[model samples]
Target: MPTIHSGPVCRLFVLLARDAPLGVVFRQGPRQLTQLFLWHTNTDTFEPGDRFVGNLSPERGDLSPDGKLLIYVAANYTMGHHNKGLPPRWTALSKPPYLTPLALWPNDEPYYLGGLFAARGSIEINLAPYALEDWREHKPSFPAGAPPEGLVFEYENLPWTPSNQLFTRLMRSGWSQVPTRQQSETVDIAFVKAHPTKPLSLVLGMGSGNSHTYTVHHEAGNAKTKLVGAVWADWDQRGRLVYSLDGKLFTAELDFPGKLQPSEIADFTTTARRRPPTPESASQW
Candidate 1:
């Protein structure tokens, strides 16, 4: 039998595009290493992107509506390997599935800084008051006072604290806070995010020192309810149920509420570390 090391459990976070049949997945395993994958919801296939020796913040990431650009917050504390002399923590913009940064901004404060797509080609980044640091391939307009045309920056110029920023991203994107009973401790909080069109909604709980965990609860019209062992889940662009469980991703048709016949999409627990080369066409970002 093959040896199974009792190492840390691998975790996955899925980011689906708003208007496209595309998704980006972050597979974190073993330790600080994280691998990125591009998911094609059109055919339920995944393509390997690249890996980073640092840690990526899923709460601080946002995929563009067209699935072309990716804005993520990454941190590398290693001193010798490839710190690049940039800040210890930074927010970066890169092509999906690849860690090769196209435009970078330095951040003094690492946690809770996030970015989102204002439109198809425009983005708003929160860098903790730091300015633009580098632009590798193509340079976008940088303005300190006001954003460029066709761009609506609501959270870029504002300061982001720990809880406010995280909650704002959820509310701003699609999620709404689910009401809970008033308690004295006030530790448990929940949110329900529904698909824009479908009748599916995912209930997620946070707080009580377990906000990073992605345990989900499924309640179908107040009839059938159960704790579906999903690490992270959401609806894909095609209105199909896409969820991650046991270090693997699954996609299933909404044949019936509260019952899912999941089809495996990708497994991250046994995924090998790879550094796929970025194609030349990826540089145009």
Candidate 2:
């Protein structure tokens, strides 16, 4: 068994850009250092980006459909903590693979942070409309040919929290919540999403204090295949299972059920922390 406090475990969480062949990968490791990478899904390549000394829950992050803009929570809450006159946490809109915000909103609380792109110009912050934005720093840059009028999305005032934030994304990705008998205090919630075309489903168990888990289950009452070393997993647009495992990204070929034919995509295990130039896209407007 691994020691609970052995040390900081390096891991990766990825947010695939909507309707684009790109991804924003959050590499968390070395305690206090969370780095970014722009991944090209088509080529299985990565471009290293900037790093920050804070926290980024990737589940609370989103990328624009154009794969040009990113919305995420940059939080570090400590009792009575202060950072050079900065808030403990804030929601930021930035260019992919960078922490420099094109726009910023001070989160009233941790749970109130994070956002998603609803359409070409519409954005939802905290599952709420763009009006909920605090407007601390408001300057959103769009790529060439993007509509400017619909930047603000119309969203319902739904209850938003760190937990439900994740659930919202899961539901959007075709996952349905499954009621679980909570026998322990740590057990929180779980969701399952079946393959769009396959007879298999992916089960996700995210607990209150326990570790998050993912497994592949056969809907034919056959087997529940636990993806070894899987920290996060989901079916990609190609019906392949893409997951970040042991500090690297991989895509599995589901040719044979109950067996994982894992193929490495990118090896992020050795990515060193460094300052990267602002991507050219963020430099405009």
lDDT of 2: 0.71
Candidate 1: the clashing residue pairs are none
Candidate 1 local lDDT, residue 43? 86
Name the top lDDT candidate.
2
Q: Tens digit of lDDT per residue, candidate 2, span 1-285?
A: 111223335788888765778888888887877888888887877888888777877778777877888888887676545645556777777877877666666654555678776645877776333433534343233333343455674335644777767777778667898875622244467788888898998888777664777878886756677775577788766677898777777887664457667788876767555655775766443
Which portions of model 2 miss their true places by more than 4 Å? Answer: 1-9, 76-86, 127-147, 153-159, 181-188, 255-257, 273-276
| Model 1 CA deviation exceeding 4 Å by range | 1-9, 129-157, 182-187, 195-198, 212-221, 253-257, 273-275
Task: Write down the lDDT of every candidate, Cα atoms only.
Answer: 0.66, 0.71
lDDT of 1 by residue, 1-285 (tens): 112234437878888887788989888876877888898999877888878777688767788888877888888777864455655666767788886666666565655366777655566666443333333321233322233366544444555665666676677657787665521134377767776665567666665765433322344454333335566776677766677766777776544445555677776788555655788655544
Candidate 2: count of backbone clashes, pairs at least 3 residues apart or interchain: 0
Candidate 2 displacement at residue 219 in angstroms: 3.0
| Structural similarity to truth (TM-score) of each candidate | 0.78, 0.80
Shift in Å, residue 244, candidate 2: 1.5
